[model samples]
Target: MSAAPQMNAQHINAITNAAVIIVKEHLGMQTGFSKPYVSGSQFMSSDISVVMGVNGTLEGQIICTMKNQTALSIVGSMMGGMKVETLDEMGWSAIQEFGNWVAGRAASELAKAEAAIDISPPVINEGRSTFRVEKTFLTIPLTSEAGEVLLHVSITPRVNE
Candidate 1:
């Protein structure tokens, strides 16, 4: 872990918008951005996702997390049925793939802007009910037929100057 990634309002907005586009486009749902949740000792926890950060010039994370219901609905929608009750192996895989797509989309957006961006492979977690981030700079809320999950982008950018 190098120094935490630092980001500004513009970068935050850019990342948020790009990430949201990826989810909405895939799940046919809309992701909302509300007041960010702060982090401290034993802070709130949500989903654990692939945290990609570019340390050379800019630094940030492309975090993705979806609730079980959300994941199930998304998986169900993709498979053309709502009969699915839970996220099976196939449903889990669907969530991971969606995570990759969103991360990749965000990276593409940054790359198009000529920003150095590094992305990590998607990491799948079960509920992340106890996971905690030391930093809470940015957060995004996604809503689907399943449910809503929060994506908190905790980056300590290097370009604070």
Candidate 2:
């Protein structure tokens, strides 16, 4: 196994700030973040999660997790206050787009700190699941009027080839 690359504080800050900004600006919800904590071996995800991969200066995943009701509420807010009783195809697509916005903002923030990075398209995961990785994850729980969303971040400096 490769040695674990050091995770920079700037990178973490950039990602968390990006998430908070997106929630506030796009979702129109004020948010507060709890202290970040590290999870070993695995993370038990919520009912719904949007996972995106990061590469370039940093490598790993950024997962946005929340309960099903929270997801529906968020989608509803995104759709101009339309009530979303269920997650239809359009709702799922909106959720994915939300993830894309977060990732894109994170990339922009990282770049401002001179950390060039690329992010993959978001993948939505429904139902509760356990995510295991050799690398540890730093989870930040963001509390908002809509609900609590957990941001699971596992990123490290890229190893030189």
Candidate 3:
């Protein structure tokens, strides 16, 4: 096995920008992100989380976490202001589609910097949970009108044997 690939400033910027753009474009809400920091192999998620795997040039996971209310608010906005008190099956599917939008946007942004990547289908986790991995993650907290959404990015270059 080889050492994990280090994510540089450019990669981090691309990811952060992608998240911000997605929130603004899809949810029609502006988002401001805080300073990104590195985390250990374990991540404590919030009430709801959307986890997706990254492959191709990069490998790892990107997780979007937020409070249950926040999830409802986002789903509401995605559904054109329909009030969402609970996450029904359709609401849950909307949340997953939100993750897909972020992942697709991230891939596009990374490709602009010459990094081709593929994102897996998103998996939604309801309730708090801890995600453990072998590689460190770069976490960025994005604040918007709906609420605070944490974007946990753990990615490294895929080494070819």
Q: lDDT value for candidate 1?
A: 0.61
In candidate 1, residue 125 scores what lDDT?
63
Q: Per-residue lDDT for 104-137 in model 2, tens only?
A: 9999999998989899999999999999988889
CA shift at 4, candidate 3, in angstroms?
3.0
Ranking by lDDT: 2, 3, 1
For candidate 3, write residues 1-161 as lDDT tens digits: 65667876677788888988988988999889787777779989999999999999888889999999999999999999899999999999999998999899999999988889999999999889998888898889999998999999888788788
Instruction: Give the C-alpha lDDT of model 3.
Output: 0.90
lDDT per residue for candidate 1 within 1-161, as digits (tens), equals 45644555665566666767865776666666656654432334454343444443566455666655666776786676556787778877777777777666766776666666666666676756554545554556655445765666654445555
**Structural similarity to truth (TM-score) of each candidate:** 0.74, 0.96, 0.95
Q: Which stretches of candidate 3 lie over 4 Å from their true place?
A: none
Badly placed stretches (over 4 Å) of model 2 are 1-3
Alpha-carbon error at 45 in model 3, in Å?
A: 0.4
Locate the minimum summed-lDDT window of 10 residues in model 2.
1-10
RMSD of each: 4.0, 1.3, 1.2
* Residue 14 shift from truth in candidate 2, angstroms: 0.2
